[model samples]
Each structure stands twice: as C-alpha cells, then as structure tokens.
Target: MLYWTLKYVLLGPLLKLFWPTKVTGLDNIPKTGGAIVASNHLAVVDSFFLPTHVKRRIVFLAKSEYFTEPGIKGKFKKWFFSGTGQYPVDRSGGSAGQAALDTGVRLLREGRLLGVYPEGTRSPDGRLHKGKTGIARMALQARVPVIPVAMVGTDKVNPIGSKMWWPRRIEIHIGAPLDFSRYDGLAGDRFVERSIADEVMYNLMELSGQEYVDIYAARAKELADAEHAGTRVAVPMQEHARDATRTPETEAS
Candidate 1:
C-alpha cells in the first residue's frame, strides 16, 4: 500500500535519518482497537513524524483546503495526503464542525486510530492551548480511550511560515490512555465536555512541560496578528478565566 511504502521505503527513512527522533511510552498506544490519539499541535510536521513512529496507520482529519486547492500542486497535495491516510474535513464552525466530529466518531467505531489535535490549530506561540471539546465528544460517542501525546521540538524543525525544515532533535512522549467511561452517556453535555477537554490539555501540559494557555490557539493567532498590524481587538472575557498564577508571555515568531 502507498502508506506503508511511504513510511518504510520513502519519506519515513529520510525523516528518521535527518531528524533523530526519540519516542517514549509508545507502548501506551493500544495494540488494536479504536482510540483517540490526542496531541498538542506545535507545527505542521507534527503530523508527519508522529505517524512514522506509530506502527498502526493514523487517520487525521485535515482541513478541507488541503484537498481543494487548484492546479497541479493541489493535485499532488491531494494525492499525497490521501495516500498517507489523511481525509479532508471542513474546519468551519457550526454544522461543518459537527459533521467533522461525526466523521471522527465513525472512524473510531470502525476500529481505526484517529489522530486529533485538540487545540484545533497549531499553537501560535509554542505553548499548549485550550483543547476543543470535539475530541471529548468523539471519544464519548465512540466509546474509545483518549491517548495524550506530547510532540517536543517539532516547532523548531518546522517553524511557522518557513519553507525550509531544519534538522532538530524531536521527542515524542506518549502518555497513558485516559478513560472517560464514567461520563459514558454525557457526550452532548457542554460542561462535561469542557472538563474532559481540560483534562486532556492538562496531561499534555505535564507531558510536554510547556506553558498552558487557556485561550484557543486560533484566537491567540488572531490576537497576535492584530497586534502585529498595530490594531486592537477585544479579549474575550472567558479567556480571562485563565489561571492567575500563570503569567502571560508574548507570542513567538
């Protein structure tokens, strides 16, 4: 299959040779069955490296734009992403978001490993961001465990807005699977979902030893961009609920 071919004979060997990745707690991943592999989104390459280390194929719900671009480059991207076990899903909110969650649940029910970045987007400042509750909902609905993975140093290798990748040491720390069976029937409850989402982020914070930001990564990016443009945007009151003990830091380039 194309996936194995790429992993074993093509891309995987090249990346391993250049990046020098170190993975720990890999045995925490279930040998077989549906489970959610929740991780912090550091950089785009996080997708590439994680899958190469895991034995089973990981199906990621990539943003639809990756599959819908025009022209020859777009065609190549579509073919490559599809061949590597990624499916396109609309990331727009409302109905599209719900539809993506449904697709993830369906995949889990079919006994496939679902890779998810609960932060919803890559961290704009190398700090862990609040997790979207969709991951919690999918796990509850699919009756699957959630495995937290921490990807360290990927941001350095694939810095945002940089076309070239640098050779950097990468560490992948896989944590024990989290079971939310106690909330088995509470999939649609927002409060319960938030609690579950927070728990996952907390584990990632500990695993990666990165500062935790309670705001969503998308919002942080928006704020950072606005600041860079010398404009002001109102901070959401809810984001102010972040821990007072933690001081905020400027966004990293």
Candidate 2:
C-alpha cells in the first residue's frame, strides 16, 4: 500500500535521520476501534511525527486545497495526502466547519483513529492556543475516549516559513485517555464544551510545557505577523505568558 510504502519504506527512514523522535506513553493509544487523538499543533511537522510514532494507522483532516491543485505537483500532493491517510476539509467558515466535524464523527463511528488539532491551526510561536470544541463534540457524539497528545521541540526544527529543516530533538507524549463519561449527554451545553476543551488543553500544557493562550491560533499568527512588520503590535509570547505565568495551581488545575 502507498501508506506503508511512503511511511516505513521512504519518508519514515528519512525522518528518523533528520530528527530524533522520542515517544512516551504510546501504550495509552487504543489498539482498535474509534477514538480521538487530540493534539497540540506547534509545527507543520507535528502532524507527521505524532501519528507515525503510533503503531496504528491514524487518519487526519487536512486542508481541502491540497486535494485539488492544477498541476503535476498537485497530483502528487493529492496522492501523498491520500496515501498517508489524510482527507481534506474546506477551511472556510459555516458549512465547511460543520462538514469537517460531520466527517470526523462518521469516521469515528466506523471505528478509526481520528486525529485532530483542537486549536484548528498551528501555533505561530510554539505556544499552546485556545482549543476549539469540535474534538470534544466528536468524541461525545461518537461515545469514544479522547486521548490527549503533546508534541514538543518540532517547531524549532522546521519553524514557520522555513523551507530548510534542521536536526532537532522532538518529543511526543501520549497522556492517558481523558474520560468525559460524567457529561456523556451534555456535549451540547456550552459549559460542558468549555470544560472538555480545558481538560484537553491541561494535558497538552503539561506535556509540551508551552505557555497557554486562550486565543485562537490563527488570530495569534496574524498578531505575530503584524508585530514582525514593525507596525507597533504586541508580541504573543509576552502576552500569553502574562496569563499563564506558571502557577502551582495551574499544574493542579
């Protein structure tokens, strides 16, 4: 199959050469059936590293543009993306968002591992971002366990806007599966959704040790870009640190 061929036979070996991938608590992943692997998005490589480390084949929802480009490179991109167990979803708002979640739920119902970044996009400065409630909703709707995952040190290797990659140490931590049984039928409630999102973020914070921001990742990226342009804007790091200033209670929370 193209998946195994590209993974173990090709890109997998090359990935091992460039960056050392250290995975912890991989036993937490379920061997079969439907479950959600919720992860923190830091670098683009985060997508490649997390699922590959796991023994089972994990499917992810990627940007829809990848599936439909008008050239040879586009065809290759489509093949590679599909070969690697990724399906594209429209990133535009409204119907697109609903369709993505619907597809995820459908996959889970069929007993498959659905990988998702609750932040909706990658963090610009390697910090944690506010998680969307979609992951929680999918798990609750499908009645499956949600596994919290953390990927660290990848952003430093690939970084944002860099074509060249460097060797770097990477860590993938798979914490225990989070149980939302208590709120089994309450996924529709906003309060329950917020609580679930917080729980997912809590584990990611502990794993990656990145400062958590209660803002969307895409907005943070926009803010960071404005600051880089010398247009007089606030740095996301300092602002994020101010709220998540590392308190003992924060860890306990």
lDDT of each: 0.85, 0.77
Question: Model 2, range 1-253, lDDT digits (tens) per residue?
Answer: 8888878988788888778888899899998989988888766677677767888888887668788988999998898887777877765654656777878888899999988888877777778988777777888889899999988887788777776677999888899998888888886776687788888898889987889977877778887778888676654553332111010000000
lDDT of 1 at 156: 95
Cα TM-score of candidate 2: 0.86
Show the colliding residue pairs in model 2.
none
What TM-score goes with each of the models? 0.90, 0.86
lDDT of 1 by residue, 127-229 (tens): 8998888888899999999999999999999899886789999999999999999999998898898899999999999999999987988789999999999
- Which regions of candidate 2 fall more than 4 Å away from where they truly are? 90-94, 229-253
lDDT assessment of candidate 1: 0.85
Off by over 4 Å in 1: 68-72, 90-94, 239-253
- In TM-score terms, candidate 1 sits at 0.90
Clash number for every model? 0, 0
Q: Cα deviation in Å at residue 10, candidate 2?
A: 0.9
Evaluate residue 249 in candidate 2 and report its C-alpha lDDT on the 0 to 100 scale: 9
